[model samples]
Target: MNHHKITSDHLQKKAYVYVRQSTLGQVLHHQESTDRQYALKDKALTLGWNEKEIRTLDRDLGMSGAQSEKREDFKTLLADVSLGEVGAVLALEASRLARSNTDWHRLIELCSLTGTLILDEDGVYDPADFNDGLLLGIKGTMSAAELHFLRGRLQGGKRNKAERGELRFPLPVGLCWDEAGGIVLDPDQEVQGAVWMVFRLFQETGSAYGVAHQFAAKGLKFPKRAYGGVWDGKLIWGHLTDSRVLSILKNPAYAGVYAFGRFRCVKEILQDGQIRQRVRKMPRDSWLVEIQNHHEGYTTWNEYLANQDQLERNRTQRPENILPQAAREGLALLQGLLVCGKCGRRLTVRYQGNGGIYPIYECNWRKREGRSKRSCMFLSCPPLDQAVAERVLAAVSPEQLQLALAAQDELLARDGSLRRQWEMRLQRAQYEADLAQRRYEQVDPDHRLVAASLEARWNKALAQVDEVRRQMEEFCRQQTRTFTEQQRQQILGLANDFPRLWRESATSAKDKKRMLRLLLEDITVERGADREVQLHVRWTGGACEDLTVTLPARIQDRLRYPAERIDEIRRLATEHTDAQIAALLNKRGQRSSRGKRFTGKMIGWIRYKHRIPAVELKRPDERTVAEVASRFGVSHGVVYYWIDRNILPARQQAANRPHWITLTDAKARELQDWVQSSKRIAKRSLKRQSA
Candidate 1:
């Protein structure tokens, strides 16, 4: 009846039809193809299959068949064929089922083993036969090749359009295409203002988060383009997010540049055996096409590149690769800019003391990472901060005159604006009062009912006028009281007295930090011996300076001994003992150069170190037997014998003092004869003792 293989068994089993499209765009625009595939159910019914035996798998209609795992309908069709349940599989074309040979041939192999028939617009064939299997394999391969050729042709056309910067896509917020086929800024003034404000605030604050915060603080909202739904192509206002601000800043379209292939779709296989598509942002240099000055933009291309560089530098957590981040509000001057010289890691700041008045910088990255904490450096905040601040001020001092003049102009403008605002309020109040009076006057006195209410309204308007006038007077008075000529002169003189301006209480820490960040890129600190710290500062313009600063003296600072004190101790050791010398030093309110109270043992140690002997002192005219023996070149016993025999006159100044020997010239002559006689007597006694 038909040149198609069909049997009772095939008729008893269900027939399945699989349908798919490469993209949702195709499914929407090529409805004829989808209808043709879906109409395969009628074909199956006409092939002796009941309505209950006919099945259609259309879940993959808008999904690509490049990878079968992503097409659940294709998987279900293959499952039925492999289980020998599907009698026949039908599609408008073989490519509609699968565009991959690996998937298409696998389906054919399963259908062949299950004795199922494959059908398409061409014809129906039983894949179980060798001839049918060979023919279907060729068809499957040709279908896969056709799919590739179609995709290649489409991609070639897209790339050609992109190369000429003519490919159209959804534009970012604040940009639109006109009827003349030219790019222009969003016609909505509010949208343009919001976009421009984001760039301006980023330039001032140097941070995306800062821009978002400023808008939030000002109670302003940013507009985004509504892409779909009832409000499509309309402006939707919402709070500005950091990511949104960053995206606006990073987009080169804001710089009037036509860029293509900024991002590409990447396919990844999931753990659950499905393919997922992700969008990856390509590097700027890797973009396929870029055409500057192709549209109206808020900034120049060079400015756009600068903004990108700034955003890259703002990554404080990645300090190892880029420069430090902009300053944040904190007590410490160098917050994100401090790097540990020892560990080459960023230092963390911790606020200590009551109310966090004292900030301490510590490099404890290793400790936090469960590594060794032995190589950390610690530094107090104030001394190091003051050193860096002085350096910064010195560097910027040459510009202080210009800065002061600018400040004066800014202040004058601000005051003028305030006065103008107050004047406007006063004028408005006066106009209201005048209007109320006119309305009251227009009502005749005979109309007392309307006159009474109008009179009350006039009185209220007059009261408001008076209140505004009073407020204006108070504002003027306060303005006059605030800035005197002397104060103005002081502000002008800040060029010569920058320290005063820098230390003024009116200067916020945040402002100071911002100033520092403008000049300094980073500061590497290393601890040195004797409470000294060395700072290696990298400036914004690639210049570096090393500064060595001594830490502030504390109550617990170690000190050294003074040379004068040591000499005095040595001289005193000759006359006084260790204890006496220590007592004398303590009495004189002298302390060890180390700031410690000296003791007898300390004095002894000093004496031993200086090689100064301890000499017991005597009265000015008093001497001991040892002294006399040393003076006369005689033994101490001989002197003792002379003193016992009273040959020499001796007297003691006090019991503790040594004996005083008055050996005058006459006594010296007599002592010499006595000594000669003692020698002869000693010789005779020695002879007798020998016998």
Candidate 2:
């Protein structure tokens, strides 16, 4: 009955045996399952195939049978089976080959077409037989359903454990698992101090990079514990990187909270048809598990939340929301704090002029997006900065004394922190040296192999101690001498009478921006009247203030004379000449809008701009060329001929103006007689003796 379906033709092919496990952990712990799978080689040998022809596929061990996509050796097995190279496929159970119905049915179909025999602990059967094929189909379906049941149960257990805050995981640097299976602060005092100092400096600087800068300036090292290696359960000290600072800040374990699933992996298909998993950080409310106050914390829960907010505020180029960007180098005091009330978008700053001496703020979102042709508004830097500074100074004036005293205390505390870090480092080195000394003394000198090693280790530890001591000495040498108590009191006495520290050169523009962000949520600006703007300042606690600041006129408007100045010039123009008007303006101490003394050309330009007529200063006897020609009863050519011959005295108002001729009754009568006597005008003049 075992070989009922096995034929002589099938016995000519080789036999195949497949082995697999669902996970690496299962492969390590479940030896019986692996042994059972390997024992199938014997089954293959007995199923009408020679021992030399029996091949085993063990490369697929410790890999899941759920999918054939990533299983290389399993793919080889399928290739051989479909090629009719296999007389029989042997496993302890058919389900070991695949846990998915699709893969299981495919293998069964290939065997049936190739007329191969299937062998398991149950019995030997040919998939070509109708009864055996039907039975194999039932087993394939059962195998896939069993995987679902197993996966659901395993996941349910994990969720139950996590919900109770009992799921054990690796803790962050400041906390560790004690021998009693409870979370406790690290026993290393230096490590604890370094961690606490990071939180404190972050609060002071309000940026992650600033925290790292503090560590670098202090010449301090940060500690990280190793996991799952030869150096496991040991502290590793090295340079504190910005990325590490962010990791420490983002971790909830440092805040004494048990959190799970703060991040999750999502699978996506690339454009090239390959699949990849990307890790995305989930928001706080989206975390799967959270247990507050689960252990001692470096900061309170509220403080942790505040740190997150501060970190968010420090990011730039995040064009959404009303959060102000981190303070950076630039002269734009309202860099990230200004919002356009018209379009409700953030205003951008642009530096202009020679050497970028001028900064202008404007909102051009719609213009950039091609939705509008005009910008919302623009304001020059000086006036706007001065206005904001006035408001800020008035608000902060009442806190000067307190702020100055706090600054002194903060400075002292910063120095003390550095000294304490160095001291702790030296103490830890001393203890390590002492431990090495004890180990060396406990060893016997007769056993040279062990004693030599211990002695060398002791010497190395002592060298470390000496090196740290020298470093501390150098640090102390570089530190400024402390002021006497009386001197400190004298310095403090100027605190109340001191000027606004915010306006002093000691305060940089970046610091001013940071302070401004702390006090004001946002300043919304909209265009008001011509050359004016409305600033709606929103304080941190929901208080609002309105400020109206007049912007300087545009370049075209500023250079042109004012309306009243032009009117005064026009009233002066009807009575005085260009030169006379210039002299009159100089006498009255009236200067042009450009802060220069007005000249005749300046008055002429004002006339051109306003289209005002200049005064007629020509004398009644000083007639124009046309009037002289008419009085002499001759054409204008005859008059010009007389002037060209110096017979007529003519004057011009500069080169471009018209010419004037001098004429009197005696000269006119003589000119009329000469014109009648001149033969050139006798033929053209009607008043001549036309007869």
Residue-by-residue lDDT tens digits, candidate 2, 327-415: 87789999878898988888888899999868889888888889899998777877888898788666555455357557657866787
Positional deviation of 229 in candidate 1, in angstroms?
A: 4.0
- Candidates' lDDT values, in order? 0.82, 0.83
The TM-score that candidate 1 achieves is: 0.63
- What tens-digit string does per-residue lDDT give for candidate 1 at 1-691? 3335788899899989887888889999999888888898888887788899988888987788778766888888988899999999988887888878988889888988999899998889888788888998888889888888998999899989978877888899999988876789998898899998999999899899999999999999998888888999988789999999889988999999999999999989789866778999999889989998998899999899999888887775653643556677788988778889887888877898899888988887777777884649778998989999988777656375456456657867787889999999999999999999999999999999999999999999999999999989988865623456776676556556666667889988877888778778889998899889999999986779999999987644445456788789878877777777888998899888576778878887777776777665555765678877655556677787787788877875334545667667787777666655686645654564566
Which residue pairs in candidate 2 have backbone atoms (N, alpha carbon, C) closer than 3 angstroms, thus clashing? Answer: none
TM-score of each: 0.63, 0.63
For model 1, give the RMSD to the true fold: 20.2
